[model samples]
Target: MYFYNLLSKLKYIFTLVITTPYYGWIIFLQIISGFFSIAGIPMLIPVLEYIRTDISGAEKQGHMGFFNYVFSFIGVRPSFYSVLIVSSVLILLGQILVFVSTTIAQFAQIKLSGEYRKKLFNSYLAVDWLWLTRDKSGEMNHAIIREVELASVAHLNSQRIVIYLTQLMVFLALSIKLSFKVTMLAFVIYGFLIIINAKNTSYVQSLSENFNETFKRLSTLTANILQNKKFFKSSIAYKGFVSKVFHCIDQTMHTAKILNIREQLQISWTFLVTFTFLICLIMSHRILRVGFSELLVVLLVFQRLSPQFSSLFENYLALNKNIPIHQSITHRLNDIKKNKELCGDEIYQFNKSITFKEVGFRYPEGKRVINNINLEIKPCQTVAFVGTSGAGKSTILDLILCLLKPARGTIFYGEISHDRLDIFAFRKEVAYVSQ
Candidate 1:
């Protein structure tokens, strides 16, 4: 109920209307679709109730205000015939809107997803080669696909918020006009339900994240093995690798099984809470001094609004479940962006000259790969460094190529310090062939 940080973070997603004109149309249509559908259901409920009560005619039914005006505008009074006609029309119109809206929104979702993927592709295109090699290509591919998918569904928040708010307002207005006391009592029960859900959210979110990560790892392991089927058939090492992968998968699946149980339990609790709330509302209305017809109408409206409220909670849970993965992907993307920025506008422009002035480097293990190494490659001259395996030959080349920065010294490309020079621009002039 009071997730300030989460709410703040989600604001951008909810503001789809203001964000872009294209998404605005998608949001507008989706909102209209859900509203008309939900409103039509509730609008017909009273008509069905009247019919069930053996009321032969709708003239005895006293209904005024918006629905009455709507019916009257079509030359139909508040009779059973008019109610039937109006409800049928509303239902038909609602269905048509739903179809059109879903089609348009789906098209927009696909378009936005394509755009998101293109942006990530462009990022890869613009980034330097060094950053690309730092991670396995498959991992980067996964990250790109996953992150862009996240961006693609960003409009879901907008759709939910708009639909829920509109439904809540319409239902609340109708309910209050019928009986304010009943509406207030329903809200109290809803508030309590929300509080209970809030208490369990943290645990639910943790379990969700754990389950997702385990599932992803399991998928990645399988994909990696399948992609290297030839190597697995030929190499002795592949057996050990496959065994390790299966072991990891087993452990992950075991955890996932437990998480699945917890998730089912959580879902059950949510339904239990909702059912309890509905029971309370029914009991309260039954005991109240309100007339049977009024009670029936109130209960019917509550039945509709309750689900809308439940939808809000469901969306909240979904958002909580996804936030961790979304954040992780966002973090990785930001790191990639930072790396791209750090690599300046230097494209490979190596005119056969590269220098390392007392270069030094330490790997992540704190072991020095190159220490105080000084080297020079003359312009257009054939030069080679040969040594036993594990010597600093490749390390020196890595430094000269500006792939790894020196810890103790500097590299120069044509008298320009590599760090100060536009690395993106300088890299364009360089060609690397590594064994």
Candidate 2:
């Protein structure tokens, strides 16, 4: 059950929290963009092979793959300069596609972020008032505002994950074509780092939630302190104010620093692997007597792939950090509909007297606030109940509107019971003015 809940939240972050429901085309664009971003990765192999063997103004070197096809299209004896131009053009096209793909990712992210906020806000409106009242002011404020922003970041990170994963695969494929030994070394170094990081994912996740909860508590505390500064000041409560909470907040911040350090290490470990791979490649070039151009291509590919891979790694850490906000949002909509007040078909008539017969009320798990009240209000009557603060004035008004049902007794709306009437229609007929 616990694992299923976690999986559900992860799924929610990807579909509901990060993107719109109608995101099939957007996801298709992501895959296509990812493909285009790495188009140039393998082009160098065929291009360089063509340049080295086929067009060196010597014994004819055989052409293959894309380069071979292009030469076939030209259908004439080609100059060395023409081969260079063809390769350059292919690389240029790849770069253009990469740029276009990036633009598409950014555009999709903007559109998805807007859609998530709208979807979440609507879900908030549909939540049960009982659940809504458990938190401060309508909803968890961050769930509406701050968490939505985090969700935008989540979208951006997810896009990076796709793009960078594609780039890594392309680079590895090219490296394998160049030399199996060099590729293995590259794989071992980076793969080890990923494996080590994966083992700590649970710890990282816990830190994420701890940081989120602590920061939320601190935010609430700060808001309360400011809003009620007069009460706190007069009560001599400002001196030790927030001391324990601040300690908790500070510890959470320290945990955040630890997480950041780990993320930095994950990224730095990649750089270390890159440099190590470079050194190993140079040694292999000297020992294996491989062509410098070929080795250089492998080295350049690794260098290019590293930054994207690092970006991907950092984004993974960031995504983990922000997923709690995603889960909180999905929780709002999940299994919550059953708790909302159900409406009846009947609408109460207000033509006759409304009666509260030995009506009693209390919040769940609390002492009764409205106790055994017997009252009646006739049509066109003006009546008021005077009470001190903490009295049940607002509770009585809420009961009249059918917002709160009596705990132990009955309330009647004209000739019908309150529960039988449609609360929305009943409330509409009555006017409530609150200051």
Instruction: Indicate which candidate wins on lDDT.
Output: 2
The residue-level lDDT of candidate 1 at 83 comes to: 63
Tens digits of per-residue lDDT for model 1 on 1-435? 468845764574455434433555655655575566445544554565576676555444554346777666767667666666666666577557645654665566567667656666777645544566665555556556664565445445445545565666667776786777777776787777777766565566687667556655655666677778888889897878878777767876776676557556656776777678668767776576666666677776777777777676665565556556555556666766876745644444556467778878887668787888777787878888889987888877767666677778888776677777776666566688768
Alpha-carbon runs more than 4 Å astray in model 2: 1-61, 70-82, 123-126, 137-139, 335-338, 348-352, 388-391, 428-430
Candidate 1 lDDT for residue 353:
62
Model 1 global lDDT (CA atoms, 0 to 1): 0.64
For model 2, residues 108-204, the per-residue Cα lDDT tens digits are: 7677667767876666645555566665542366556676667666666666566567667766777777678777877787878675655455567
List runs of model 1 lying over 4 Å from the truth: 1-23, 26-62, 65-84, 91-121, 124-142, 145-158, 215-244, 266-286, 289-300, 341-352, 355-366, 370-376, 408-410, 420-422, 429-431
Pairing residues by index, what is the TM-score of model 2? 0.83
* Global lDDT scores for all candidate models: 0.64, 0.67
Q: Which candidate is the best by TM-score?
A: 2
